[model samples]
Target: MIHGCRAIKRADCFHSKGHRNPCRSSSNPYMILFGAVEIAFSQIPDFDQIWWLSIVAAAMSFTYATIGLSLGIAQTVANGGFRGSLTGVSVAAGVSPAQKVWRSLQAFGDISFAYSYAYILIEIQDTIRAPPPSEAAVMKRATMVSVATTTFFYMMCGCLGYAAFGAAAPDNLLTGFGFYEPFWLLDVANAAIVVHLVGAYQVFVQPLFAFVEARAAARWPGSRFLAREVRVGPFALSVFRLTWRTAFVCLTTVAAMLLPFFGDVVGLLGAISFWPLTVYFPVEMYIKQHGVRRWSTRWVCLQTLSAACFLVSVAGAVGSTAGVVGAVKLHRPFSGY
Candidate 1:
């Protein structure tokens, strides 16, 4: 996963320079340095062995929280006083309240998909050591707590950010902040975000790696790829693991390079998958597994909600796809070259 991220970064650099061939002479030195760095990162022990990833994740979250607070305060001060306003900082003079409300709702729909980590929690359920019943209860409580905490911080940042920059706010709050006074603080915040994303990428991708490797091993039991295993201290690293993971990384890196607009891709994915993965499936599964009666209020409400989510997902998916197409048209492949 780290290797893939590095590859993406390298590709982005080449893309930025309008270079048709990423391996051109001008990039060779940087490529060598990146390769060395990737090797060092890959050598780090697995999460189970080192357990420092969680700590890093925690620190990253804290850093983000700090950034939100700082930006909110700065924006508020710049706007005039802390008016505790939830409406954006600079509303157009002629726009009606109805228009503002509609815009706010649209923004909410666009961003609500960003926090679909409920499915991710399900993927990592095995990490919980308790018995089935106890584990389920623990996970339920943890999910509730996590959702509440995240919602609080998200609301704080959104409200504060809007209050600060109002109608003039950029899509990215950090970018909107720009190189104002104390630019170094913005640099630190961005660095923290990069570190956070590295850990997040690994967390999300590991399950896919496991699933693919398991399938390959099942299909080709006698292949050298499945047979060769080396003991690296306490970790049993296999040849197949190294090869397939590298391949996976390369595939993702190439994809990212081909579509370098990060926000558009994320929007497309979130729009297409968020409803089914985050809301519809979970709600329907719970109703079915728990044997909720078809006519019951809970069942009816859940089904209605699922249907609504499906409609929203379809709309969001269409909008996001259009956005991507527009971006592609605006920025042609190797246009920088």
Candidate 2:
């Protein structure tokens, strides 16, 4: 969202001023504004209730992605041919061989992060009613469709963006200021991103909210702070939920302010969470649930897949951590990157 806001601002500035003016700005204010919006949304009870928000989020996701893809295609056409090399960013004067290797590994983290929706698959599956078709079947179809569509857009946008900008491509395709002429369109794309992220933030954190609140209620079953609700106008509001969720949002907001390097943070998070949440746990659970014979062909294949993903996760973590360290050394906390 901070990036989105920055992009919008940059677009506006570049439109008014010349492109060479270097219209820099701070992301802290936008970060705070986003936090404030999230605090309000956090009050909503859980996943089942925010179906509309999820729908809107999905739509906004498509809106911005389409805009970005279109822009990339246009830029590539203007260039008259594809630009980037298959090996990726070249070994320039400032870029060392080790740095290039780390960046290549970091790209794995980015790809893993892009497909990390598996973390919430079961939560989504739980929302379906018992069916003429079983919940498993519904989820299987849904997973396949969602993953395929997402992968398609990811590949199109990534490949096109690379073709357009080559080694100079920005970490964020839209916010990277690649297309400066279409100012209003850029603004719309960034605005859509902000909207998309607003809902996405809540979607991702709701599980954590539920987990913490559930544990609190279990630990102190009789406490009013944990269990009591007060009427706020026509709505029933839980005191504990409000307080705890607010604190959690504030803490995370502060962390974001401290570490404002979006690319590195995202890569690091994807590296850290991808394997355990998306691969190992799910694969292990499937093997256990289905009673697959140990060391059988099926089991071996699954184990091999898990092992490969684990290695990717490790390499990604190392590269992303290096990126973060390098960023921190170059810039101070709470300062604009």
Segments in model 2 whose C-alpha atoms lie over 4 Å from true places: none
- lDDT by residue (64-117, candidate 1, tens digit) is 667866777776887686543444533455656654544444443466466656
Q: Estimate each model's TM-score.
A: 0.76, 0.97
lDDT of 1 at 270: 71
Over 4 Å off, model 1:
1-51, 81-112, 131-133, 176-179, 230-236, 334-337
RMSD of each: 7.0, 1.2
C-alpha lDDT of all candidate models, in order: 0.61, 0.89
Q: Which consecutive 10 residues in model 1 have the weakest lDDT in total?
A: 23-32
lDDT by residue (tens digit), candidate 2, 1-337: 8999999999999999989989999888998998999999999998778788988888999998999999999999999999989988888836789999988888888888887777788778878999879999999998899899999998999999999999888787889887887899989889999999999988888888888888887898889677778899999989888888999999999899899988888888999999999999999999999999999999999999999999999999899998989888987788865
Q: What's the TM for model 2?
A: 0.97
